[model samples]
Target chain A: MSERIRDFLRRRDDDGPCVVVDLDIVRDNYETFAKALPDTSVYYAVKANPAPEILSLLESLGSSFDCASVGEIEMVLATGASADRISYGNTIKKERDIAKAHAYGVRLFAVDCPEEVEKIARAAPGSRVFCRVLCDGAGAEWPLSRKFGCDPAMAPDVLEHAHRLGLQAYGVSFHVGSQQANLQAWDFALAMAAGVFQEMAVRGIDLKMVNMGGGFPTRYLKDVPGVPSYGAAIFGSLTKHFGNRLPATIIEPGRGMVGNAGLIEAEVVLISKKSEQDEVRWVYLDIGKFHGLAETMDEAIRYPIRTEKDGAETVPCVLAGPTCDSVDVLYEKTPYPLPVSLSIGDKVLIEATGAYTTTYSSVGFNGFAPLASYVI
Target chain B: MSERIRDFLRRRDDDGPCVVVDLDIVRDNYETFAKALPDTSVYYAVKANPAPEILSLLESLGSSFDCASVGEIEMVLATGASADRISYGNTIKKERDIAKAHAYGVRLFAVDCPEEVEKIARAAPGSRVFCRVLCDGAGAEWPLSRKFGCDPAMAPDVLEHAHRLGLQAYGVSFHVGSQQANLQAWDFALAMAAGVFQEMAVRGIDLKMVNMGGGFPTRYLKDVPGVPSYGAAIFGSLTKHFGNRLPATIIEPGRGMVGNAGLIEAEVVLISKKSEQDEVRWVYLDIGKFHGLAETMDEAIRYPIRTEKDGAETVPCVLAGPTCDSVDVLYEKTPYPLPVSLSIGDKVLIEATGAYTTTYSSVGFNGFAPLASYVI
Candidate 1:
């Protein structure tokens, strides 16, 4: 945890659980990305953590924004970032929402199908459009399904459809996956984008940019390759595929930008076992799946936890949230190891919660307030 | 769909998706439960949908509340219901929250372990506490895990611990499961409760109540046994197990009370295939798992969807929410079939969404507003 977060928690007198984000970590992450991929533009994914503080900080540091909706576009514009710096990154958008984003001065959009291209062509007239191709997302902890992208073979037609309707067919895009661990995952995705570029070239349409979407992961239980490593691999792949005719590149980093910048402090509410023969104890916390830990669905994301009695002997425990819903259990299939001496009312720290925690929190599930956030 | 909701939708000029709840359906459901189990008290679970209109209506109908937190207790009390009408039903709670509920005159709580019983004893003094035992959750669409309850064999000691403290050991509680289908599910749970009652009687502590927790099913894509069948089955179990010494009974119904009373109307954003050879079409909606349909996680709850072209030829389609997140896809593992004529911008109706939709919505995931609710 950052020292700023530690100091904030030490002085906190709050009644419920909360997350504290250290802006210094975010700044450092941004500089690392900038220095690593000096030629590519960094478009911070607003959906990751859209706190105004983080947006303003990135804006001041000359980072662009990848917005998923008109609401996110407005948030980026509120940071005084020009519309040209904002990309409507979500491929599935309502036609009315596309019109609203167009009115708000956003001219860049992502499309995966001809129907979506037609919507943008009518609503955002002369907007620049990027066609997202499918990636298997094989090595991602939270592997993406075939939901967001179309086949790479179909992308040329989607862009040609956009070009036919007075829209600018500007580029190609693909996401390896979120929290991706494999360093070479981007190479295969880039090869697919290069095929799309070649197909578009056969049609006399020169694609200007290649949007290498977010796959850079944050450190959870295991260490991830640094941004420099990702940059070296991506640059190697770009040079191998494009030769001297390299396209302008853009990278959207959501979790990698803000994942480790925040920490969540929660209290142990209760600890008990089902029976005398039960080998595992159940640890109940003040926060749970509905509160902010929704990523634990199917135990996909295992976050590191710490307590005051950390050095004490530990036991395998089934951790859960303080909700009446049965699905509120967090770690059960694979039990989380917590201190055996962990008693009721003792505080516990959940690490690497900076990116997706606050936004995934339910409005008032089981009558608990949304996760409180403080940007230090 | 109810004519009341249809009229509401006909008159609505608002943008974006919304859920409209017809209070008449809720009233009918409550009356059915009352007539079915004439001897039992109905404690409406507030976590289902804590809208003020529903709470006030239920309060006016002389219904008690099963609240999961102090905030829910406050919401119930705001409806002018007396403190005696509220039970702190969640087994996991902080000591300070227990004190707050005690200060507000709530005298009943649920517990599964000695640690929790000690907390209630110290904080709420002579409040009545019920011990929840574990249920296998057999034949349940949304089967509950061993998260909220202790083993059945261990309940007597927990209540004995409560009795040793200043707290009153009132009775036992168990949830068969949410959306439980089998009529015999309650038979096994009631047998377990009877064993606890016999154990308590042997200890010279005559337990006066048996809190049969909620597992009542609501109509979704399939027809479930009605409230009368559940009532009859439970009564048979009580008579057979208790031998005419039946305890005062309480039923907490969250989904059964409100699930069928509301309908969500959403606009189709896009419809596309991943490839030219792909057979299934992906249908994206304006509202998704984050917006309020969180029950669709794992496709466990298959909500019945309706479209204007329902009579047309059908094809299997993967439905998704319009967000950048890949996990937002709803019915993918087992694709839901839709009319072949369904196209972008067409209105689709999601039925039986009253219970868990509104509260499950994120604050603003992907910049989309929380699911709007209207009680007519």
Candidate 2:
């Protein structure tokens, strides 16, 4: 947390879970990646926060956006980001969605199969397409190979069909599973892409881009090693493999870029009796499953919790939302005790929930509206 | 479920999980419950589906509402439901929320603590009050005994304070756990409430209501013997316990009323091979974690999925969502075969999603927006 953030926290009235998106931290993260991976254009995945203010910040930073839906594309457009800077990348789309994207002037799209090619051809006949190849690097931990992307063996057929049909076909893209713990997965995926690129060359088709889909893990929980750095060991290998000849590279960083940049300051609604188990006692927060904290119960990711009033004094308490459901628990286990002597009226600020916590995950259950975000 | 729904599925040019709420079914459910529980006023839990249209149907059916947040109260009010007819029943609330509910003219509020009583007195002094009591139906599987509600022992003190403070204390409310399998649990809670009411009467405090908050089960899967009919057994016991002295009863029926009235329809985006599992197959749908289906996933509720086309062959398949996250699997298992051969373009509909699926539970994740409900 920055001194500015601490200073801001000191001044705000913590009535409920006030989502604070730190523009400074977001710019820092964006600058860090931009300075490190100068070769690739960053597409700030709008699915992370999509707050127009945050999207404007990324647009100011000159980052492109990878939108998976028409709503997201509209969010970016609402920020006055150009359509060319937005890629309609979710290949499996409805025909109406394809036409909508084209109507909105999204020229480039990701394609996974011949069926998708036919649909795209019908919807946006002149659109530039990227053939998504199923890379073997999708290991057991992450399973993108199952639902998306055409098999590498079938990519040639897709490329040929697109060429024969008059739909403008471009490069290849593959996601080596989302949030792969192993950095080698990307290397394996790139090598596989290289094979596909070579195969396309054999068939005399020219390619222009290679999109490495977003899955860069955000440091949600502490001591979880931050995403594999974009420094020498990784980007150096990328330059070594594709060389300067590597297609204009694109990386969608959703959680990694913005996950740690925000926090929700929620009021303590009530405190139950101390638990007999070593597990921390629970303090029910005023915000719940509706306030973008759905991932806490669903993904089991612990949002670092602390008492904003006195950060040093903390005890382990399983923070729960006010929903009547049992699954509304935000963190099953944590060291943060209910700020001692805290009553129903006190405030507890949850840390590092900047990513999927709110914008994408506010299942507005229990009558709570999706919380309003304040960009600090 | 209906031929019209089947026709809608046949006419869909694009596919994914789309839920349709039958207004007629909602009205029927309301009538069924209303007829069964005559003296009781049915407060349709807006947390089930706060869609204005759905709420309007319930409101038109002469049902009151149980609102847990200001948003839900606002949604209910938007349907022209009187504020007095809606209860801001979330025991855990912020000062602003209490004030908002008061501003919205919601006079009936629930409080779990003396501090909350003080706040309510200060904020909405004239509001009708219900003391939330912790009815730990012993040996029952309910988890909410850990949060909200004063123990029966603490109730007198709280009630005494409310009476002394000149707050309009009226009733008691307790939530049995969701999908409460044990109907005996109601007897235990009512017995406890009866004792509390008698003790309050002795203290010269008059009570007007005993809200048995929602926990009524919905039969989504086939195996569960179905929600124990709260008919003669439970209400008859309540009538015997309270007799002619019983206040107007309030039941927050969420799943029971609406669960069977809605169906989520989705198109099979992909049918892929699983590597390790036996003949692993996945049918990726449009609705991901962003929809209310996430609740079904988190709760481990089995949603029956069926494929529909004009007239086609059927097949069995596990359903998944479009999000890149592996946890976005909708169904880890399906009992019956899909109604038709689920090609990449085919559509599938999951039944019994009316209650907590779309209305209260949807975050715009993976760039996927919340699905809108159409009244059929």
Candidate 3:
């Protein structure tokens, strides 16, 4: 445990459910990656946690932003970051937002379809744009690239459309997936990007940038390779796949940059056996899926939990959030191990919650207040 | 179609995603239930959609409120609702919130556990407290009561605890579930409630109220019977189980009260064949689960969709949201039939969306804005 968490918990006995973000840990996570990947430029994905404190720290450390919407652009710009550092990374965008983002001085945008590429050409003339190719994203905790990418065969056509529309078809991008633990997925994706590059080259369009989109793993309940492991694998893949000529590398890391820095301090509201005959215990916490831990929907991300009651006999229990909604249960499909003696008012530290916690909170589900956070 | 919706669509060309709530339809739905259940008091569950406009309308119609937290209580109070008309319906509540709600003059509270009952008894002494017995909530589209109810065997102890703590021990509550379709489910749930009532009676605790928690169905993708049908089934079940000596009845309606009164106008962002060889077509929309259609998770409570190309040849397409997150895909497990010609910029109407749309929107998922609603 860090000194910041210890200090926070000393005062968090009755403060209710809140996220504690340690500045030191966040700084360490950021600097460690920067040290490992000297050849690649890091653009922090803003959708993970847009808290001004996190953005400000990354900004002070000379980090750029990978934005999905105008709100992300504004959030980063408000933190004293340059607008030129922002890339509108969501392929699907409103025409007005495209014009607005361009007006705000954003130069790079992501496009997957011809209509979107044309919209970008019309809304933000001559802006540098990247085409994202479909990634199978196997061996990932969350296969997020499924919703944003187009077919590999269509990449040459997409870049051709971009060139015809008077936009800079500057790059090809693909996400292995969120929390990509397997290093082999990158080798496959990079080799696939090489195919798209060759196809585009045949079409007389030489893409200048190879955008290795965010999928960087964060240590949660499962152990994952450190920043150096990913950096080494990615660099090796780039060299082997591109063969002495690689495009300008752009690596966007969301969870990897911020996931380990924050912890959620949630109070155990009630520890009840659902029924007398039922053996499984249900532990309800003050904070639930709606409040912020929405990523636990299908147990895709198992957040590590710590309690003050250590060395006590532990039992497998279903974790639930404090809400009237049944879907608020965090882990019923996959039962979580918790101390059998866990009771009301006992605090549980949900670790590595810095990335997706606050951003995914429903505005006010069941009238419960949204998750609150503090950067120490 | 109502004139309000027609007028909105006629003028909504190229407009972004928005919810259009029609007051005329809301009033009609309210009056339909009011005419059917003259014996039952209506307490609108504010968690469904806590729009101030909806609250003000319900307030004007002399409808009471079922609140989950102090925030809901304040929202109702801000709408000029008397504290007497509000019930803190959530079984789980923080100590400070219980005290705050009591300070704001709320006197009715729901409890499923002994600790919560005691907390309320201390926070709001002599308050009208209702014990929620465990309900399987079978046969409902959304099985909601599972999270808030105690086992029937434990109901007596909970009510006894409430009585011992100086609470009024006013009622027993159970939900058939949200979007309950079968009337027979009510028969079984009420029979289960009668068991708890009998146990409490044996303990010399006579409950004064019976809360038939929100389960009334709304007209969505599947047609549901009108309010009269539900009222008839409930009345028949009450007479059969409770005999001539019945407690005062309170029906908390969330989806049933507001589901059909609002519709969402969303623009289709992309319609693409998933791949050259793949058979599935993916339709991307501006509005998605994070922006209000969260009930679509697990294919429960599907809202009916409409487009101007009503007569066009339709094909099954995988629906998705505009965000880059893979989970943002609206309907992939269960594909929806959409017009084959539906292209970019075309609008799709998500019908019967008044209940869980705006309140469930993530604050800002993927930098995309939270849902916007307009009263027509």
Candidate 4:
């Protein structure tokens, strides 16, 4: 760890626990994401980390935001992002939420069901809308079919309903699912979405936007290959399908933009032996599942723990959280190279935890406060 | 869902997604936990939902807090719980945490290492402490023997170190792991603690307290007979072992007190047929893995879903969460007997989610606001 990181950990207030975000890395990540798709508007998924500074940084990078709730809209609006740039992406929403979106002048929203269509139409009669279609790619990491999207079979009818309500249903949206290994999944989904739009046009509805919803892949560990560049492939496919008539494209990338930019700094509390099972050591850290790192329960990615000196000395340690609950383990059998001793008070960094880290906390446990970020 | 619960959900500003906590059931749970351990002063574990309201309720119920951080001490202090009543139960802590605890008049704390003893001696000078002993019966649920406790073999040396510091070394504390299925595990732990205390007495260190650190079981599901009576077998064994001369027993029950008192009320988002698995269907709800229900992960606990009318007819549904992540499943093959006419707007009460439900959250995604709770 740099003296800077150690300085921050040492400065933790006696009153609360915190997740220290690196705004400088976040900005660099935003720039990298923007440089990849210069023509496409990247709607930073506000769900990643809604810290005001994070939103401000994304806005500074000229990124739009994909909001799911009225509070998200308010958060983005508070950052002074234009309402035209925000998309209320929840396909299924309550009446009050729809009303709040319209009241706040959020023009673009996704509609997955006719009930949501009716709700949006009644609440925001003239809003720009996107019809979310469910496309199941067999090889995607997580398939979004049949859950949050309109079935392809129902797409034409959805467009018809949107037109009947006099709403400018101008876009088609599909989520390729997060951490997806197959970049071709986006190609297949966009092709299917194009067919849906053509089908909609045959039924007399003209579309003006195509939102390839946020599922951009991100890689944390160095050994794993960096996520494939879907921007080039997606743009290539979209151009081939629409033939220069392609609508303004929007991409909502949450984890991709921020997942790898943050690091969680914690300290080893104690080391213990469990049994004859190779001296299972427990390193109780100050952080817990409440920090964004534990959400990787879905993925097999383990952030390699690097000590203050950045040496790879390996030792097998079970990283447990400060919470008394036994399930508060960050890693169960994580191997840390051990030539150097890991005693109490040694600071360790768990990498790539920026996105959902601080924003996901209830901030009510004890007086434990959420982490704050400063631009390095 | 009750009208009151509906009121909590409805009052949400539709800006962000949130977990709603019912403070009413929390107050009732404090009373229930206190009533069960009438003779023993209950030290409510601050780790479980350490909201100020929770601390206030525990204080109002005449229960103390088992704090793990200086921040937790301040949280309990803010609730008007005397600092003397709070025990810094995290056996291993930072030197700064020790300093803050001493500065704030927190005398009772737990120590697990000789180095920690040296640090605390330098930081706090004369702290009344308890040495945590590693009891062997740590069950599969959550084993503390891995991280925070010292081996019983080393207890004699730890007591000697504390004695040399001239600190008032009160007693020994042992956790029999959280969620232990073996009720016999508690008795075994009590016997082990008793032996350790007797050993300490032989070493000329008079012990005044033996905290069989709280792992009292609570019910997670209906017909799950694993959850035993909190008052009978476990506490009864403590009395049987130490008789009238037993030290002031401190039990830090975190989840047991609040686990069953609350339920998560959510709306069914999508009910979809699985294309590959012929008989498998997915019923998605608005809650996600970020909610406290994720505790059911890897555990046999089934957070049974029920309708407003308790004995409604049942149907089998695979309940999933709203997150785009595929792992955001709430229950696998949950047999929910649903009404034949069940629709999208139908409500569900996720049972036994009260304890850490609202306190543990990933509020980071899109203005997801915490849910509001109504006390009945």
Candidate 5:
């Protein structure tokens, strides 16, 4: 366990689980990304962690924001960040919310379809828009599917329609996926985005921006390469494809920016053998899937667990969240290696939990309070 | 489509999707259960749909409650429901919360462990306690796991320990599992509970209650038998097992009591083919797993879907929630047969969603608001 986590747990007064964020680590992660990609502007995705303090700190660092909804736009504005720094990244939105975001001074919007572009034209009127090119999120831990983005072949026509609607179809964008593992995924998505750019160029429409959507990986159980490696690979791919013709760049980093800075100090509520003959044990924690760790649904993303009972013989155990619902079992499908000596009241530190932890929590699930966060 | 739903769709004022609950149906569902099981006391499980209006209506109907947390207890109290009528049913609870609930006038609690019984013994001394017996939860639509139960073999000793701890070991409880479809599942559970009761009697500890925990099935896509059938099967099993003498019985009904009363009016945000040549279509809705209908996870409990173009040629489509998250795809793993004529602006009615709908919603996930419920 990290010294920061141990100290946080030792000095904790709360009875149950809470996320403790170290702003220093967050600043370091931001600087690492900033130092790596000089030409690219970082638009922190607020959906990952919308804590006001985290936003305030990142706003002070001159970081831009990628908002998904009017509520998120309001949150960013509440952080005293410039409205010009906000980009409505979500393509699926209500017309009223689009107008609201525009009224709130958001000028940049992401669109993938003609209907959405029309809505933007009517609501936001003449705002700069980026059309997302469709690509199956390959080589990512959490692969986003056909919910957003349209065909790259269709993106040119979509952009042309946006231009016809009097909106500035300024760019092309695509997401490799969230927590993209293989660096080649970036090249694949960028290639797709480039195809759209080329097709638009052929149609006498020159796109000015290339929004590289968020997929930057964060370290959890796997040995994720540093942000510099990603920067090198991305920049190399951009140079190979575009040479000196790179467009005004935008990079949205959700998980990669804030994922590594937070740790959850969860107390073990109970430990018992599920069945008398079963080999595995069941370790129940005060926090579970509903309490903000719902990303563990398929064990697609594994959070490394650290126990106070270190150096002891480890055994495979099914970890559960504190809820009456059967589906709240956190690690039954993917059992965790927990110390056999781990008992009730022992603190378990869930590492790299900052990104999708607090924001994803269900409001009062099973009457349990939403996750509490402490930014240090 | 039902007339109530058609009228609701025609009159929706909100720009986003919402859950419209028919209060008449809710009261009828309660009456149905009450009339079917005249001997059994009804305790509505508040965690399923803890809407204050629902609580108030149920309170007016003279219904008791099964609360899992202090928050739920407070909500129930706010509805003018007496605390003595509320049973703290969650086995996993902190000692302080237990004391708080007791101070709020809750005398009944369900526990599955000796540690919990001891905690209750100190916090709510001389209160009624029920020990849940472990079962595999076989033959149910949503089979519950071993999250809140103890081994049947250990129940006698556990109850004896509870008695020794100065707590009243008044009942033995077991869940057939939520949305239980099989009549035999209840018999198996009741038989197990009887064994525990017999053992307790031999130890000179008289047990006077048996909580046939909530599993009562509700109407979804398939035909579910009515409450009368369940009552007949249960009464038959109770007579066959314990002929002359019977305990004061309690049935905690969550889904069965309120599931069929609610219908979610969600707008079809977008419907598009996943790929150019891909045969399957993706239908995106305003609400998804993160929004309110999380039970769609694993498709364990399928909600019957109704579209405006019901008579049109049907095509199979993957239903998804309106979020950037990839896992928000509700029916991709199990696609639904939707109308080919269904358009983007059409509304889909999700039936039997009153229970486990609004309460489990993620607060502002992806910046979308919570599932709004209108009680008619």
Candidate 6:
């Protein structure tokens, strides 16, 4: 945990679970991305954590924003950032929402299908549009499905449709996946994007930029490669494909930008076994899937957990949230190894929680309040 | 859809997706349950919807409440219901929360382990506690894991511990599962409860109540057994297990009580194919998993969807929510069939969504507002 978070927790007098984000880490992370990719622009994905404090910090640091909806666009504008700095990044959107974003002066949008392109064409007029091509999302812990992007072969046609409807066919974009460990995953997607660029070129419609979508990893239980490694691999891939006629590039980093900057401190509510013969102990915490920690669905994102007795003997325990719903169990198929001395009311710190914890929290599932967030 | 909800939709000028609940349907559902199980008391599960209107109506109808947390208990009490009618039904809880519930005049609680019993013994001393035993949740569409309850063999000891700590060993409780269709599922659980009751009798302690936790199904894509069938089957099981020495029974129905009373009207955002050669179309809706349709996780709860062009030719389509997250896809493994004439901006009414929809909505995930609710 960051020293700022430790100090904040030591002085905290509030009850219930809460997440503490150290702005220093977020500031440092932004600089690392900026230094790693000197040419590529960084559009911080607002859906990761839309806390106004984080947005203001990133805005002051000259960072752009990638918003999923019009509500997020307004938030970015509230940070005093220009509309040009925002990219409406979600592929699926209502026509009215597109019109609203256009009214707010957001000129850049991400689109996959021709139907979406038609909506944007009427709503945003000459707004710049990027066609997101499909990636298999291999080698990522939380791999994305085919919900956002279309086939790589269809990108040219989609952009051409946008051009036909009086919208600027900006470029091609693709996401490898979330929490991606393989640096080589981007190579294939970049090649596909290059193919789209060539296809667009053949049609006499030049795509100016390549929007490389976010797949950047964050350190959890296992260490991930630094941002510099990702930057070098992506730059190498761009050179290999484009050969000296490199297009302008943009990278949307959501998890990588903020995941390691936050920590959640939760108290253990209860700990027990089903029976005397049962070997695994079930540890219930004050927070759960509905409150926060929704990323633990399917145990896909195993967070690194620490307790006061971290140096003590460890035992594999079934971790769960304090809810009546049965699906609230965090780690059960593969039990989480918590300190054997972990007791009821003892505080446990969950690291690497800054990205997707706050917003995913239900409004009042089981009457629990939303995950409290504090930006230090 | 009920006439009341249809009328509400006709008059609704709101732009975003909203759920309209017919209080008439809820009243009818309560009457059905009351008639079917004449001997049992209905403890409406507050986690199902927790709308003040629903709670006040149920309170006026003489229904007790099964609350999962202190906040839920407070919501129930706000309806002017007596605190004696509320049961803190969650098996896992913090000591402070237990004390809070006790201060709010709640005298009954659920416990699955000795540690929890100890907490209640100290915090809410002399309060009645029920032991929840684990049910395998077989034949349940949304099957619960072994997160809430303990083994049947361990229950007698748990209750004895509560008894030893100056707390009343109330009775046994078990959930067959959510969306449970198998009528015989309750047979095994009731038998286990009977075994625990006999053990308590052997120790000269009389357990008074058998809290049959909710598992009753709502009509979705397929027809499920009605309340009368479930009531009759449960009564038979109780007779077989208890042998004319029946304990006072309580049925906690969340989905079964409120599921059929609500309908969600969501607008189609976009409809398209991933590729020119792709056969299946993709249908995007204004609302999704993070909004209100969270029960559609794994496509387990397929609510019957109706479009204006329902009678026209149908085609298999993957349904998704309007979010940047790829996991927001609703129906993909088994693509849902929609009308070929269903176009963007067409209204689709999702039926049987009243129970779990409103509460599961995220607090502005992807910058979308929480699901709006209207009870008439």
Each model's C-alpha lDDT? 0.94, 0.72, 0.85, 0.69, 0.85, 0.94
Query: By lDDT, is 1 or 3 better?
Result: 1
Candidate 4 per-residue C-alpha lDDT over A1-376 given as tens digits, one digit per residue, 9 for 90 to 100: 2355557667765433345566666776677667777778889888777778888878877888988677788999998878888988876566667788888888887886666677778889888888888777555445544556766777777767887998887888888876666767878888888898888888777887889877765665543233336667777888888887887888888878777666676667655553323465667667766544566453355665667655545566676667655556767755444434677777677766766667655444444555545433
- What DockQ does each candidate score versus the true complex, computed on alpha carbons? 0.91, 0.34, 0.61, 0.34, 0.53, 0.91
Q: Chain A vs. true chain A, TM-score per candidate?
A: 0.99, 0.88, 0.97, 0.89, 0.97, 0.99
RMSD of 4: 4.6
Model 1 fnat?
Answer: 0.92
Give candidates' CA RMSD values in order.
0.8, 4.6, 2.1, 4.6, 2.5, 0.9
Model 3, residue A321: C-alpha shift (Å): 1.2
Enumerate the chain B TM-scores of all models: 0.99, 0.89, 0.96, 0.86, 0.97, 0.99
**Residues A1-376 of candidate 1: C-alpha lDDT, one tens digit per residue:** 9888999999999889998989999999999999999999999999999999999999999999999999999999999999999999999998888999999889999999999999998999999999999999989887889998898889999999999999999999999989888977899988889889998999999999999999899999998899999999999999989999999999999999999998999999999989988999999999999989999888888999999999999999999999998889899999998889999999999999998899999999999999999999
Interface RMSD of 5: 2.1
Which tens-of-lDDT digit does each residue in A179-199 have in candidate 6? 899999999988988899898
lDDT (tens digit, per residue) of candidate 3 on B261-353: 888888887676645666778888988889998988876756688898988999898888887677887787778988887877887888888
User: Per-residue lDDT of A1-376 in model 2, one digit per residue for the tens?
Assistant: 6676677878976445677888998998888777767878888878778778889999988999988788888899888888999888776677778899899989888877777787788888888888777766453233453456766777767767777778776878877665555667778777777777778788888777778876666665545434435434457556766787867788888777887888777778766543223345567787766677766543356566666457455566667787756566666544345556666767667778787767654556776657767777
What is candidate 5's lDDT per residue for B1-376, written digit by digit as tens? 3467668768777677788777788899899888888999999999988888888999999899999889899999999888888999988777788899999999999888777788889889999999988887788877787777888887887789899988899989889888888999989888888888899999999999999988998888889888999999998888877777888888989888778888898888767653366678888888899889899887777888888799899988988888878778788777899999998778788888888888788877877787888777
C-alpha TM-scores of all predictions: 0.99, 0.83, 0.96, 0.84, 0.94, 0.99
Superior by DockQ: candidate 2 or candidate 6: 6
State in Å the error of residue A123, model 5: 3.0
lDDT of 2 at B132: 84
Q: Which residue pairs clash within candidate 3?
A: B134-B150
